[model samples]
Target: MSKELLKGNVAIAEAALRAGLQAYFGYPITPQTELLEHLSKRMIELDRVFLQAESEVAAINMVYGAACTGVRVMSSSSSPGVSLMQEGLSYIAGSELPCVIVDIMRGGPGLGNILPSQGDYFQVTRSAGHGDYRPIVLAPASVQEAIDFTVLAFDLADKYRHLVLVVADGLIGLMMEPCELPPFQPVRTTRPDWALTGADERERNVITSIYLKGEEMEGYNIKTQERLATIRATEQRWVEHLTDDCDLLIVGYGTAGRIAYTAIDEARSKGLRVGLLRPQTLYPFPEQRVAELAEQVERLLVVEMNAGQMLEDVKLAVAGRAPVDFFGRMGGMVPMPDEIVSAIDESFAKMAQPA
Candidate 1:
């Protein structure tokens, strides 16, 4: 694999192409605009489909149309733009369509500035859309992980016939790092049997999110739940750094995750037995791993680019086996490595002291 330095957004667009993406639909939003810009010219050169939709809403529905044809399709936007695509995300989830959506999060209650923040953690993992459905959410801490996850998102989307959301912050999207884009064999327009493509070789296929009858809807909901259960069981992914035989553990993901590792290293130099647990999948959540590590560590300090969003999940995973504390920076601010190192030292002392 040849290595090249690329901005995260451009690497992702190139990765999607390498992953055989058949179509791309998106509108411009800061930090994520480069993705649209890169794909616009790249898609043209390959004679593939790419559209700068009138809006994020229009873009996602365009994905919906392409996905129904069993083609790998994607759309991307920053936090505010993603907020506008919620309805379409729900529709895609309800119809059980496979597609990838990228959210380069920015601070937002409404049209917040485009610096960098993980404020959309809840928006992506909990309630961005209007249904009782869950998307496979991936958080990548580096440009290489960004490229890798883009390819994995398409596979996971198709594997479950569901939506897969790649969660990033403005920092990840805008930053540059060396990455090896995977070589992919281009997939042509050979629609799947379940796809709604004229239905000539089999019975006609209908793709819609409508289930007017309550029982029919309930049945679909039950099936969706089963799919979620299976995903929870098998799809959880994460990385552990210096976790074994440690007294303090740091938990973070995406941009915050990388910082957590830096803090761990600094703490280690001072002879603190601290480690990091960087989650790659937010929804399935590496709960079991956290629980196992919690059994060994004295405390867990959750570092996030938001006000303690994933801290709640870490608390649940620890379940009183070990104490869980939080340190976060919201609204486009990032925590300094020393700040986290200080928190680790300070929190560990208090937790370790006999009362």
Candidate 2:
């Protein structure tokens, strides 16, 4: 395949289509609007389903309905827009439906701004809705990754019969880079046995989240937890740089991690033994790898565009085996490589001090 210079949002949209996306339902929001705009025309041209719903809430429900019919369905939105879909998200998860959701994060506790931010870490990794369920979350740092992960999100969702979220900040969404998209996959024509394809000759296959009885609900909850445990054990993923021999470790993800990679390279040039662990799977979180690295490093530093949201996870992984420090810029402020390099120096200084 030839590499084309593509904006992250458009790349993801095209990649999803090629990956056999049969239906798309979403409303436009900044940073991620291009994804929906691209799908609106392409889906129609391909004789697939595409509907611009009245709101995010409606869009998510549309996705839910399509997914129940066993088609590759998705929706894209920014932070606030994603919040509006939370209730719908919970319903889909509770029913064990497979679907993909793309969240291009913008500044926000409340309609913060249109700039990039990583404040959605907890919202995504913890739970996208009010439920005892944790959706699989993938954080991509580059335009290429945005395209790649979008494809992977659909596969993982179907494999586990669960929701999958591909999240990136506005930086990745708006940036342009060269990327090679996957070959087109023909959409499936046969519905899964579990799908609600209207009972014809056999007993009806009923699927619902409403297990009214206490024992029924508890039984379903146990099955959900078991599935999550399997996913956590098998799906933890991350990339490491200079980890073999380093006294200081830097942990970040998505945009923050991408920038930190540059800082760590510069620090290495200056004779600093600093490594990096950029997590790709945020929900599974690569905790085991972090725990092993914590034993090798003297200290750890977490960098982020938000106020250390991922920092707490690093601390848990470290488990006090090493000191942990955090440097962050909230409200859509991006940290430069030099700023992180300086942060590394400060961490070293702190390490040199007595406890």
| TM-score on alpha carbons, each prediction | 0.98, 0.99
Quote the lDDT for 296 in model 1: 91
Q: Which candidate gets the maximum TM-score versus the true structure?
A: 2
Estimate the TM-score for candidate 1: 0.98
Residue-by-residue lDDT tens digits, candidate 1, 241-319 = 9987788888999999999888888999998998899999998889999999999988888999988899888998999
Name the regions of candidate 2 deviating beyond 4 angstroms. Answer: none
Which 10 consecutive positions of candidate 2 have the poorest summed lDDT? 198-207
Clashing pairs in 1: none
**True-structure RMSD, every candidate:** 1.1, 0.8
Q: Could you give candidate 2's per-residue lDDT for residues 223-253 as a string of tens digits?
A: 9999999999999989998899999999999
